[model samples]
Target: MKRIPYMLLLASLLLNIYSAAVWGFACYAHSGVAERSTYYRQFTAGSDPRTFSVGAFTVTLLSLIVFIAAVRKLRGWYIAVAIVQALFALLYVWQLS
Candidate 1:
């Protein structure tokens, strides 16, 4: 069977990691302290912010693992992963906007 290209796998993995990090940061910064200013509010978390971030990180990691495993057996799945990565990138941009 033809193997998937290494560069595609690498690109997907990097994009997945980047998405997870961006999502995790958003999760971590969900809540804000009352005393802190708007600019500094996101940095402070009094309540449990880990719950969301950890969940996001775990889901992203698991998806990446599943994608890697599937891509090994079935070629061309990387295209799907790349599309997903692109969507994630778009989501990141949307967040910034």
Candidate 2:
């Protein structure tokens, strides 16, 4: 029960990393338009990059909220997590642009 928030944070981190990898591959690979499109669709499970970014943002936000609401102590740790999540969200936005 107490571990759920932490688990959510971990999940969000992994999600962002995976999305970054997918986006990077889609951008850097020297492939045909059709091939890139197909790879993007397959990597993102049929959803586009924008949609995936939004979902990742939502999960990061949810994890922060859950951590704040569930944990009574660890203020410093929470702040660190919040900072990392914020940076990730910013990176996602940058990638989309």
Candidate 3:
């Protein structure tokens, strides 16, 4: 079993989980901050499908890449890049929330 692919998958899973958790928390917290009149606030209240689709597509793509990389026995560095990308993406999700 190649280690890189598993590492990438693990990292991406962490990202997916983090994004879900942050969004969940944000939605919960918004009930208290309902009076804010920001455009972002409006977007959330409207429950934009585009936002969810984009997030799902991106995470799925990352998962596919990781799957391919693992089965193809790609180089360690490539898998490491995926892990790095996933971690940063998770951080970005938190920032957005």
Q: Point to the candidate with the largest lDDT.
A: 2
- What local lDDT score does residue 19 receive in model 1, on the 0 to 100 scale? 44
Residue-wise C-alpha lDDT for candidate 2, range 8-84, written one tens digit per residue: 88888788778778767977884676666667788888987667777787787787778778888767767888788
Which digits, one per residue and each the tens of the lDDT, describe model 1 over residues 5-88?
A: 445456555645654564456556645533223322343342233343343344444555555565645447666765665465
TM-score of model 1 (CA atoms): 0.35
Stretches of model 2 off by over 4 angstroms after superposition: 30-38, 73-79, 95-97
For every model shown, the clashing-pair count is 0, 0, 0
Report how far residue 84 has shifted in candidate 1, in Å.
1.3
What is every candidate's alpha-carbon RMSD to the true fold?
10.2, 2.8, 9.3
Better of 1 and 3 by lDDT: 3
Write the residue-wise lDDT of candidate 3 on 1-93 in tens digits: 568666756666665565456555656656644432233335445544346536654764676576775575656875675565656565555
Q: What is the lDDT of residue 68 in candidate 1?
A: 59
Model 1 root-mean-square deviation: 10.2
Mark the regions of model 1 whose C-alpha exceeds 4 Å error after superposition: 1-5, 8-12, 18-22, 25-30, 33-75
lDDT of each: 0.49, 0.78, 0.57
